[model samples]
Target: MSLVKNLLVSISCTTYNHEDYVTDAIESFLMQKTNFDFEILIHDDASTDGTSSIIKEFEEKYPDIIKPIYQTENQHLKGIKASGINVKRAKGKYLAVCEGDDYWTDPYKLQKQVDYMESHPECSLCVHAGYVVSASNKEIQRYSRPNKINKIYTAEEIIEFGGGLFLTNSMLYRTELDRNRPGFFEKAPVGDYPLAINLALQGTVYYMDELMSAYRVGDSGSWTVSSFSTIDNKIKHFDQISIMLNRINQYTNLQYQHVITRTKKRIQFYLLVEQEKFKEALKEEFKFIYSEFGYKDRARMFLQGYFPGILMSLITIKRKLNL
Candidate 1:
């Protein structure tokens, strides 16, 4: 057994088929200018695309800084999440994440987060704004909240934030938060959001306004891109979220019942719409996904769900008239 000692922070990085971008991630970790000792615990989940080999190359170069778990077979396919597995191996007081595709842009990112976490005992989690870079790296979507710096986010607020207040790559949280993680994390098929919420329940999480990272979107190995592009996958994902929320509600003694239930309903409504079972969606309460859709879109949803034939006829007529 390896002794985990004298580590101030552990960077939990999980990679699978990210050979194209894994080096940037590792270099980011190695470039941090911090006064404290930190370890990078990497897990290459049996990537067939030379991702594991790339990780091995880095491990050989920086054996002291990088500790890796190279799986023979895909662990993610067997319901094991890389962050969860990495957390179990992490020995530092604080844990940070930057997946294979995502990389830290600021060298002071670790130092800044650690300085704040050490100073503030009440904070269990710390997050910062990140730029969303396209796979081509030519375009970026900004995630800045200049007015909300050092804002303390509550458990309820994090849970109801609908998944985009911060990116997983931009988080630095307490390692002990792993101890309070619910069993659903092992099987729920989603991470980050639930993990953040779990930490928020123990202590309030804070946010920094600075952009310290770049989150790679539309990358080949991006889970968000792959998960929601297909109707079947989206429905399956919602079903998993439903089970996860049920377990969370049970664990919290129904404290987040209303919010979780509303979240579940929102997922279900979209699943129904994707499946063209809109009639069923119209029967349930509507929660406006203000972030993704607007009033006219909602009206169109209702029309398509309840009056499919009429809406189809209108669509055909509009196309014929070039309107």
Candidate 2:
């Protein structure tokens, strides 16, 4: 691991039962064209699908660059977050993320991000656009930032977007800002959003309008897949989001109160719909209108509840229109 000296970046790649996809992920990291040294902190959360074997092979081949963490048991199943574990172990100036199911497309991704961060020292995070392709690669779409490239964003700009502006896999952050996260992280659901918000609070975040990564959709081994595979799992997901947002509110001290409340109402609507509780979902529809939701979402719930025939007809027309 002699090449680990003066590491400029640390790539955190967390995997579980990703035997079919881990190699592509590792190869992407190895192909990066960066001037400075970097290390890969890949964590295998005790996969039963022989994903660990592939990781071991790569580690053997690149002993100096690929550092693998093999968990004895399924840490995610046991409520242990692999991202948190990897972050604690990563000792680099900047942090890059590439989950096992996702891979980088551009070899110059790291070099470009590093160059930006080096020149613009005030920014805490740099994010780029990515292509979202189906598992079979038949369907592809681009996920991009709302603003133009090289646009700097403050904490308020991030929160006001409601849903985040960029995808999880297309990000690089200052390790120092993320290293000391608040205690609320224990209740956090997902790593990307909360971590982005945390960094934005400390400093500005930049969005580069470049497509450097490809995110795979419908990954059966993803945490959302493993956890939210059933109706009960849907309940847990929404509840966890509530806990996470509450913790975030506590840390931010109600600065984003209205947005949090609106989010809660939105989740409440989805929770009811997932459980097929139409009556309850209708109730939440009214709750959202008074709070923050626009006319489109409001009209959707009304038609689905009051005029099923019209809603069906409208949905059919939209499908035919393909707009």
Candidate 3:
């Protein structure tokens, strides 16, 4: 097995009980065709399933490139982020992130991003378009920025987008930025959004229109599935997100105050709706943020507020019909 002498890119991945999907994620990293050497840094947070064994298998096969960190206990439960561990261990010019459930499709994905970042010194981060796949690895929808054209987004815009603007697997950023992480990041509920804001503050963020990676949704042990599992869970998660935004506000010296304020209000409105407190959500204070919702959301809120019994009956019927 040949070892990499000078690593140019470090593929950072975090996994937990991803037995069914972890193999695809690992294989995707190994299949990458790049001129410069790259290392795969996988942090398995005490996976109870076969994920650890599968990772050990890959490490045995590609001993030089695969670096596995096996945890006896799950750090995530201890409020430690597995992603940060891989980021700290990354010793490369660029850091690429792809969680265990997500996989990249294009072999040239790393090379392309590296080439762009190499030429463009102002770009601290580079992200490309990708697909949102189901738990079964079936394509569900495209995960991408709003515009189809490749463009650079400012720090203010990154703050306004609030995280879901780009997929995590598609991210390739400068590793140096993570060395001195800001205090705000520690308080963040999720790492990606705050990290994006942190990077954008350092330099411009580049968005490429190429389709490369796939983000798996509805996967077990994933943040999305767990956060949206119940109304209480959602409220707690959203509250944490709001706190993160406040930290970002302070970190940026309130330069993006207006945007941050609006973003928090939007979250507030969302939380109210999620709690089925439609009367409060429809109040005058949250009225401004109502424009953020779609037709279905508006209709549902109206029904829940005015015709709650009817709405509950409809929900029960839908559940009875298994819809």
Give per-residue lDDT, candidate 3, residue 28: 92
lDDT of candidate 2 over 1-323, digit per residue (tens)? 35567789999999988888888889999999877899999999888898899999999898989999999988876767788888898888999998997888899999998899899888889888777776655267435444444678677645534234666777898888877778666557767767777888888788887888887766675665566667677677668867877877888889888777766765665555555565555462434333332234434433322222344444433354342
| Alpha-carbon runs more than 4 Å astray in model 1 | 1-6, 142-148, 269-284, 287-323
* 204 Cα displacement, candidate 2 (Å): 1.3
lDDT per residue, candidate 1, 1-323, as tens digits?
A: 02335579999999988988898999999898887889999998888898888888888887787899989899878877778888988889999999988899999999999999999999999988777777666277544342344678778767755255677888998998785467766657778878887888889788898889988766654787678667777677778778888988888999999888776766666566557674564562653432233223333433332223344443443354344
Once fitted onto the true fold, the runs of candidate 3 whose alpha carbons sit more than 4 angstroms away are 283-323
Best by TM-score: 3
Candidate 3 per-residue lDDT over residues 123-142, each given as its tens digit: 99999888877787475643
Estimate the TM-score of every prediction.
0.82, 0.80, 0.86
Candidate 1 overall lDDT versus native: 0.75
Candidate 1: Cα lDDT at 142? 43
Candidate 3 lands at a TM-score of: 0.86
lDDT of each: 0.75, 0.73, 0.79
